[model samples]
Target chain A: WLHHPASVHQDGITVEGLIRRSLEAKEFAYCPYSRFRVGAALLAHDGKVFTGCNVENACYNLGMCAERNTICKAVSEGYRSFKAVAIASDLIDQFISPCGGCRQFMREFGTSWDVYLSKPDGSYVEMNISELLPVSFGPEDLSMKKVLKIPNKY
Target chain B: WLHHPASVHQDGITVEGLIRRSLEAKEFAYCPYSRFRVGAALLAHDGKVFTGCNVENACYNLGMCAERNTICKAVSEGYRSFKAVAIASDLIDQFISPCGGCRQFMREFGTSWDVYLSKPDGSYVEMNISELLPVSFGPEDLSMKKVLKIPNKY
Candidate 1:
């Protein structure tokens, strides 16, 4: 729930480096419609960094966000635990924040990890996943008992 | 847009076979959270079939639906145009319909493609993406001129 954290992340990587990689990851974006290229560099707990770019589809909702793509790339490669993820966009004035969907995707791993929202200028804002999605739904919610359903057909 | 199509698909595959593949695909589901396994078998115009199972995450929203997984798997392997997609679930009596997100995802390629919603007991229904997500937002919407935003900060 930080308004703006320090320049150095607790994970030992400089914010500038992660943000730079995220910006570089934008080169792989396949956005032909909106042309809003986004990139993310995810730091796995095992000391590996996975970079990903937004992959847009003709169906807007089917487009994969940069953050989620980065996470999925890591997960597909068998890296589940994350340390931090830095997101970058072309905006120079405003910091790039993750969409609600990406927030939930990042929260799937852990809440305490760092989320760096950066602009092309390298300036950034920081927040944890829990801050982005407060009072969130997690895996435990699915384990609850099913409620009664009315038999009336719609 | 269909309500209940025949047992035969226009692409030359039988409905029962596709549904059976979907059911078999469910065996690879990685849903440790919800335990609600779902599977999808996507048929490409080139006569290739790609199957995928739901891959859930600890964060509920991060869970990838079987439909999307199937699409991504196909896309990753260079199959773009889809002819049909059959979905299956363990429910014995009720057909398994795609969620709002999945419906939007399917509409990315085309609306006329077949979507088979099948149950464990072999009973099923059929529909198209147009019927599932009417008046859907798509890639074209992003090309419109941007609306002016209010300057007031919250």
Candidate 2:
């Protein structure tokens, strides 16, 4: 069923080369801690492809996943809007999804953006960022004006 | 004086190229959301330099700091131990230090590791990881055997 990439209507966006790039990106993962390699590729509105691999750290929490890394790289390069993203992991039996932290990160961009989850062999599933992280918080939540109005307990 | 790098004794680790790299890395920060740019450089045991810029996401928490990014890149490339880390930010009046998350992340490598906080013009202050993040939690605290024994509330 994964054959027809053009037919997979994810908010009217097609999955053309993201899956391949995601798979290719896996080779760059630095995951000695978990031994779980993950790769991600993002397609920007300008048709630019940004790819990232999981970079693990001795401190587990400090590690960054492939999806977040890709988004970070894309943003650093000045691309704000994204069309689609594809993620691939080595887990063949089950499709792995973006973690809570990454989902929250993705929500900062666009909730309607397409997300593809894939296994080693390229077989995959698709979902939108909204479905992955429903009712998420964003820049709107960090209201400095509201915070300053709180009475000092001390 | 800032000119004499050797005088900046950060727990006995001398300030070398870290300051320059940190400043240069700042150019790549993706911080459209916060507009707070940060850059970091890590010196590995082998004397290799890994640099990173703060990569922000739409979900603020999903953002990766320059310090963590440097560590991730270093670790992913197969370097486990680190010698010193340098951080640079745009905050000119005060030297910007690593946040709590980055501090906890740095503690994973070594408590005594040198940490340098710098401004745009290369003026900096130095501290060790332990001093920055005291009474920190780490992998050791996650003793699964002990946690498993705790009775389930449900």
Candidate 3:
């Protein structure tokens, strides 16, 4: 556990190349509207890495975060389980953090996966999905039993 | 404008085939979690239609709304401009409404496009993007001038 330099590294999670790939992916950010670029590198359970950058839309709320972009691509490509995800941005004062929507998206798979929020200088802080989204709403609440009837209120 | 039936049709916007397509698309919803299915059919400016159903993830927040799914698919297929979109759901008591996230996603294109929120009985309520999300944040808010420098706070 390299706890010095004010960085938290997760147990058994190798972040050596993940952080760098996220930084590289930031170059592809289509953020003409925000001018705020972000990138992510997601490591699947099978050891494949998916890199993605923020794709902003004309409507600010439609803008997809780097974390969600990579995760959704991985999901669409048939990757269900993931090991870790590393995020990068140009902000030097504080390490990059996933937005609320991205946090929810990351929580969709499982909670124990590592998330590396890194700075341009490679310093990083690690946290799991549960820590990021406490008391989260997941699939269980909607589907309890095979015969659970939800209140029909749209 | 079909006023007495409580269904509003936009001037020169055709939604006859769109509503049926949306309802048909609902059969394909990948919603093992919520059990609440939704579907959308988007009409591009070039007379093409794209249909999508809600794709739910084990993570509740990661669920992609049908409206967004159709719009994103259309956008990826080189359809930047759209005329209208019709949404369908099983709830017959009231017409289905887009979630806050989908409303924002729909607003990404423009404020003038029509949205037909429909019930299983083929009745619908029409509203525009601006009516759904008022005083919205858009591209102009971020990129106002060529020399606008945003506050550098992460």
The top-ranked prediction according to lDDT is 1
Residues B52-149 of candidate 3 have per-residue lDDT tens digits of 78767766556677887676555544466888999999998988999988887877778899888888987787888998989987766655665766
Which candidate number maximizes DockQ?
A: 2
Per-model TM-score on C-alpha atoms: 0.57, 0.71, 0.56
Estimate, for each residue in B86-111, the C-alpha lDDT of model 1 and write its tens digit.
Answer: 99988887889999888887777778
User: Candidate 3: misplaced stretches above 4 Å?
Assistant: A1-14, A144-154, B1-30, B34-62, B65-154
lDDT of 2 by residue, B1-154 (tens): 1334456433333464678878888888878789999988888887787788898765566678888877766654556689889899899888888998888878777788888888787777778888897887765665445635657878
Give the interface RMSD of candidate 2: 3.7
Question: Which of the CAPRI classes, incorrect, acceptable, medium or high, describes model 1?
Answer: incorrect
Off by over 4 Å in 2: A1-37, A44-50, A53-63, A77-81, A130-154, B1-16, B32-34, B46-48, B57-59, B76-79, B134-136, B140-148, B151-154
Q: For each candidate, C-alpha RMSD in Å? A: 7.2, 5.5, 8.3
As a whole number from 0 to 100, the lDDT of residue B67 in candidate 2 is 83
TM-score of 3: 0.56
Q: Rank the candidates by TM-score, best first.
A: 2, 1, 3
Q: Residue B77 deviation, candidate 3, in Å? A: 15
Model 1, span A15-37: residue lDDT tens: 77888889988877767777888
lDDT of each: 0.78, 0.77, 0.77
Q: Clashing pairs in model 1?
A: A108-B59
| Two-chain DockQ for each candidate model | 0.20, 0.30, 0.17
**What fnat does each of the candidate structures reach?**
0.30, 0.40, 0.27
Residue A131 of model 1, lDDT score: 83
